[model samples]
Target chain A: MSTPVTSNPAQEESTVDHSKIKVSPEEMEAYDQSGRKPVLLGFFIAVVWLLIGTVLGDLSSFKFDRPDLLTEQAYLTFGRIRPAHLNVMVYGWASTAMFSVSLWLMPRLCRTPLRWGNLAVIGILVWTVGLGVGIALLLAGHGDGLEWLELDRQWADPLLVIGAAMVGASVWKTLAARNVHHLYVSIWYVAASYPWFLIIFLAGNMPFYKGVESAAVNWFYAHNALGLWLTTINLGLIYYLLPKIIGRPIYSYWLSLVGFWGLALFYALNGMHHLIGGPLPSWMIATSITASIMMIVPVVAVGINQHMTVVGRFGAMRYSPALTLAVIAAMSYTAVSLQGILTALVSVNRITHFTHWTIAHSHLGLYMFVTLSLFGGMYYILPRVLKKEWPSRRLVRAHILLVGGGMVLYIVALGIGGVLQGLSLLAPGEGFEASVSSAKPWLLLRSVSAVIISAGHLVFAYHAYLLAFTSRNSLTRHPPFYELKPVLVKKRVP
Target chain B: MTRILVLIMGAMATVIFALVILVILPNSMLSDLKAPPQLKQPGQQELLGRQLYISNGCIYCHTQQVRDPVFTTDIHKGLGNRPSVPADYVYDAPHLLGTMRTGPDLFNVGTRLPDRNWHLLHLYQPRALVPWSIMPGFPFLFEHKPTAEAGDKVLDIPKPYAPSEGVVIISKEAEALVAYLISLQHNYPAPDSDALEEVQP
Candidate 1:
C-alpha cells in the first residue's frame, strides 16, 4: 500500500483509458451533425407556437381588462378562448417545441442519433391536424366543457392515440440506436414519461368515468400530464444540459436517482388533493394530501441537485439563454413544489381549495416552472436547429426582461387576489359577492402582464420567422447586439 | 440482513401504493358528501329550471356548495347559499354544486334579483344582462327557427342542441336559467326575524 502499486487491494488505484475519454474528430463531427438540425427546427416551431398562444392568451386576458373587446363574436369570448389559449400553450406551443428539443437532446444524451427523422415530421403534422380540429370545435361551442380535456371526444381520443403512436416509434428507434451504455438521468426521465402517459391518459379519459367521477378524473389527468410528462421531461433535459455545458459531473447522481423514484411514486396520486374536503372519499382525498406532502422528498433532492450543480458555475447565465431560464426554472420548481406541499395541508386547503388561491398555486407550476424551463430549453435549442444564431439578441434580451417581469407581476397579482378571495369568503359574516370583487383587481393586473407578455411574444415571433423563413447567412450577418460582446462559457477552475 | 427486508419492502411499497388509485375511480357527488340543506320550500318554476341548467352546462360555472357560516367566499362576488339542503335538490336529476365560477356562483342571486324581467334581458345578451360578464352569450338557446313570444312552455324538451323560444317575451331556456338563479339564497329557512339574517363584514 505504501508503494503506489497498480495491483494493491487496499489502494484501489483506477486506470482510465484516455483514448476512450477523448472524442475523436470523427466522433465530434458525428455529435455536431446529429445535434444541430433537430434543435434548430424544434426551437423555431416553439417560438411560433409561443407567438400564437400568447396572442390568444392576451385576448382572453383583455376580456377581463375590458370585457367588451369581442362581445359580438362568440368564439372570442373568454369562456371559449381561455381553454383554447391553455391548450395551445400546452400542446401547440410548449409541448410540441419541447418535443423537438427533446428529440435532439434525448438522442445526444443517450449517445445516439435520432432514429427516423422523417417520421418525426409526420408526427408533428398529425398532432397539428388534431389540435387544429380540436381548437375549431371548441370555438364553435361544441366543446365538452371539460377543462384540459375540452377536445370533443371524437377528436381527442384519436389524436392522443396517433400522437402516441408516432412518438412511440420515434422513442423506440432512438433507444435502440444508442452509442453509449450508462444512459444519462435525462434519458431515464424522458423514457419513463411517454408510456406512463399512454396508460394513465387512456385510463383516466376512459368514458366509464362519466359525470362527477369523470370530473375527478379530469383534474387527475390535467395535473398528472404536467407532473409525469411535461415537468419530468423538462427537468430531465435540464439535468443533462446544465452539467454537460458547464463541464461538471452532477453534484450527486445518487440524489438524482432517488429524486426520480420519489417523484414517480408520489406525483400521480397528488391529483386528488385538489378535491380535498369535497364530495370525494376521506381516504381518496387523504391519500392525495399525504402523497402531496410526501412530495417534499423529491422536491428537496432534485432542487439541491440542480441548484448545487449550477451554484459556483452560474456565471454561464450571462452568455447562455438556456442557462438563465433554466436556473430561474430550477429556483421556481423548488418554490412552487414547496408551496404545493404547504398548500396540501388540510388547514391550508380549507382556505385555498375552490378559490382563486388554487389558480395561483397552479400558475406557479405551469407558467413559472414548466413554461420557463421549456422556454429556456428552446432558447438553447433553436440556434443549433436552425443552423444560425438568433437575428437579434436585443429581441432576446427584451423578451427575457418582459416575460420575467410579466410573469412575476401576473403571478403575484393573481396570488394576492386569490388569497383575499378565499379568506374573505371564508371569514364569518362575509358575502360571496365580496370575494368576486376582490379578484377583479388582480385579474386586471394579470391583463396588463398579459400585454407585456404579448410584446415579448411579438419579438419572439420576429426572431422565429428569421430562423424559419430567412436564409442562415443573412441571420449570421445580423446577429443580435448582445452576441457582439462574444458571450462564451465562463470557466472558473483555472 | 433485517435492514435488507426493509429495503425490499421499501422498493415494493410503491407498487402496492398505486393500488389505492384504482379504487378511487367511482366518486360521490358533492350533494352526497354533506347533510341535506335546511331550506323549507322551492317553487315549481325553480325546480324545472334546474333541469335545464344541467342539460345546458350552466353547472360548469356555477357551483352550488355554499360555504359554512364561518366563510362566505362566494357571497362577495354575487353568489351564496342559505345553508344548502339535500332536499333543495331532492327533485333534482343531477345535483349541481355549481363548481367553476368562471362567471360567478349564483347561490344567493335569487333573493336580490326577484325581478324576472332583468334576468331575461341579461340572458338574451349577457352584456345587456351583465355587461362585464366573461360568460359566453347563449344566442343558441334563444329560438331563431320557431320564434315564440308569449309564455313559458313546460315540455319534455329532448333535443339539447335545438333552441326553444317560448311563446312569451323570453325564451324558456332563459326563464330556466333565471328560475335557477332565483332559487339561490343565503337563507334556506327564510329568517322571520331581520336580526337572524346573515351579514358579511
Candidate 2:
C-alpha cells in the first residue's frame, strides 16, 4: 500500500508529522524532475513584470484624472508611461510568459528534450532587456511618437530583429522533432506569428518610410502586431483548450480551416480602418472597411463552431476554469470585433474616433479577450507542463473573481465615459473645455476602475506563485478522470 | 455539451448590432448637423500649397476637425461649426480624420494664418513663424544646393531661368499639400438663394 502524496508544498511543510508520510515510486520520480524549478522561477519573474505593468497602468490613469498630478517630472509624465504601460503589458508580461510556456510545452508536445536550453535562457534575457531599454528610451523622450511602435528608432530595429531571432530558433527546434501527425492549432498560430511579426515589423520601422508613408505604415503595424501577432496566438489556445476541456472533438474541422484562412486574409488589410478619415486614399480606406466588415465571416463561423462544440456545457462552466475563461474570450471576440467593424465605419467613427471609446474597445479586445484567454490557457497548460497541481483552490477562485469583476467594471465605465464625452463635444455651442468638464466624472470613475484592476492582477500573481512552487507529491491526489456518459453536442448548420 | 449561455449572448449581439447600424447611424447622419457652410476650393496656387502641406506629414501633428460634440468640448472652439458634416468632405478624396492634436487642428487655418508671406516664412522655420511652434522646419523643402566655397542659402523661390541665373523650381507635390492646408476654412455658408435652388434641385 502507498501513502497519498500531497502536491501542495505549503500544506505538507506546515503539517506536524513528517514521519507519517510514504511516497510512491511515481511520486519520487516526479519529485526528481528538475524542469519544475525553472518554470517556478520564470513565474516569479513574470509576477514582477505584472506588478510593473499594473503600476504603470494605474499611474498613467491618474494623469487622466489629475492632468497636473506630478506634472513637473518630465519622465513621469502621462505620455512616457502610457507607452511604458502598454509595452510592459504587451511585451514584458504577455510575450515573456508566452515564450516561457512555449519553450517548456513544445518539447513535451513533440516528445523530445529541448536541444539548446541556453538558447531559451538567452531569449528571455534579450527579450527582457529589449523591453527595459526600449521603455527607457521612450521615457527619455526619444520615442518615435507612434503608438505600439513608440520605442526609439535607434533601439527599435535591433530589438525587433534580435528578439525575433531568439523566439524563432527555440520554436524551430521544438517543431523539428514531432511525435504526433497533427500539428495542433496552437502550434500553427504560434509558428506563423513569429515570422509574420518579424516581416511586418521590419517593413514598418526600418527608418525607410519617412514622410507621408510613415503615418500610414505606423497605423498598419500598430493594428497588425496586436491582431495577427498576439490575438492569433490566443485564438490557437482556445481552439485546443475548448475542445480538450470538454473531452470532445472540435465541432467542425472544416470550419476551423475556414476560420483560419478568413482571419489571415481579412486581418492584414483591417489596419486601414484606423486611418478612416486620415489623408490616406479612398481606395485604401474602402479596402480596409471591406476587409473589416468581412471579418464578421470568420468571427461568426468561429463563434458558432466553438459554441456548438460546447452545447449544453453550462455545468462545466461551473466546474472548469479553462472552459469559463475560453468561453468569455469567445464572447469578447464577437463584442470587440463588432465594435471594431462599427468604429471602422466613417459616419459612426465621427464620434468614436479620437475618444476614450476607442481605448475601451481596445481593452475589451486586448485585455478582456486576448489576455484573458491566454491566462485561461495557462491555467490548464501550466499544471501539465510543470507536472504539478495547484496548491490551493481558494487562491484560484480569488484570482478568477477579482479579475473578472474588475474588468467588467472597467470596460463598462470607460464606454459610458467615452459616449458622454463624445455627445457633449458634439453638442452645439459647447466650448472644448466645457465638454471636457462634462467627461471628468467619467474619467474619475475610470481611475477607480484602474485601481480595482491592479488589485485583481496582484491577486492573480499571488495565485500563480503558489501554483508554480508547489510539488506534485504534496497535492491531495485527484482521480485522473471521472467516468461519465458523454452528452451529444449539436452539429453546426451551413 | 453546448454553450446554452453564449447562444443567448449570440442572439443578443445580432439584435444590438442591428439596432446600432439601422436606428442609431441613420438618425444622426440625416439630422440637421448645423456644421459650417461649404467653402470653395483653393486657388490653384493655394491648392499647390495644400498638397505641399500634406506631402510633408503636417497632418500627423495637426487635425482639421474640432472634436465631435459627443466626443469633446472642442466643437465651438473652432467656432462657426457645430459638428462637421459629410458635405464638408465631399471633395476630399482621402478623408483626413486625424486622431491627435499634438499641434492645433487647422480647421480654420485660412483665418488663423491669413498672411501669404507668413505661410512662406513659417514653412522655412516654424519656430520663427509661431514663436511657440514645436514643429521642425522644412529646410529641405526649400531649394538650397551649395555653391563652390560658398555658404548654403535657399535657391530663391524661382528664377526667371535663363543662361544668366540658376535656380530649380519647387516640385508640384510639395505645392499640392500646402495648397490643401491653405484651403481650410471654418466660415463659409452657402448663399440663401443658392441654398433654395440646390435643395429643390
Q: Model 1, DockQ value?
A: 0.12
**Regions of model 1 farther than 4 Å from truth:** A1-45, A472-494, B1-61, B67-118, B125-201
Query: Which runs in model 2 stand beyond 4 Å of their true positions?
Result: A1-44, A108-111, A114-117, A470-473, A478-494, B1-201
Predicted candidate 2 versus true structure: per-residue lDDT over A217-260, tens digit per residue:
66667777777777776777777677667766567755765676
- How does model 1 score by TM-score? 0.79
Which docking class does model 2 fall in? incorrect
Per-model TM-score versus the true fold: 0.79, 0.68
Q: Give the best candidate by DockQ.
A: 1
